[model samples]
Target: MSQFAENVSKRLCSLDVFRGMTMFLLIAEAAGFHEHFSTVTEGTVFSGIALQLHHHPWNGLRFWDLIQPFFMFIVGVAMPFSLRKRLAAGNQKKVTLHILRRCALLFCFGGLIALCL
Candidate 1:
């Protein structure tokens, strides 16, 4: 494999591909040009797939609902890689401090967004 491909594989694997595919299907096909895939997709697929991915009326799980979880998982996965790089570069102090700061910031941001909603 090429150096770039090898480096990326060391970072994340096919799970990232799945996330990208999910995002592409939701954004490109569902939100934008769904008509293009209508003829090619089977009856059970892509037919209101976007709508179904969203949460149910009151409460329940759904494939579309997992998108947020997948994104949060990627961020969690990134923390170790990012912290390791900082430590390797002699920034262990900064890395240690930033982890908590980032967590707090993310929590606050999420809270604010939820409040607005």
Candidate 2:
């Protein structure tokens, strides 16, 4: 493998793990694990954890509310390493432009999907 690729891979292990755990939590939320726990273990410590696992009803924040921000933070943490790796691999200006455009597209698509939801 390329040196740049190797360097990025080595540098990003922790970031990748963080990102994966955030995604897993998001998926668990989607699967209604929190709701299930709340129903099954009401008034118990597990239920308390279940409550924290869900988003606040309104005008407040919960641990679940941090999932998106945590995901974004992970992305932000990796961006510099990724860009440096690409540059070190001798990618051209056009390739950098393409990467920027793709990032914009992803942001737009995410916003659109959120709106639809």
Poorly placed runs, candidate 2 (over 4 Å): 1-9, 107-117
How much lDDT does each candidate structure score? 0.69, 0.82
lDDT of 1 by residue, 36-103 (tens): 54444547556666455444564667665776788888677776776787788777677778878988
Candidate 1 clashes between residue pairs 3 or more apart in a chain or in different chains:
none
* Every model's TM-score: 0.57, 0.75
lDDT of candidate 2 over 1-117, digit per residue (tens): 687786663576778789889888888879987788789989777876777887877757778888888978987888888778788787689667979899899999999999999
- Model 2: lDDT equals 0.82
TM-score of 2: 0.75
- Count of backbone collisions in candidate 1: 0
The local lDDT score (0 to 100) that residue 109 gets in candidate 2 is 100
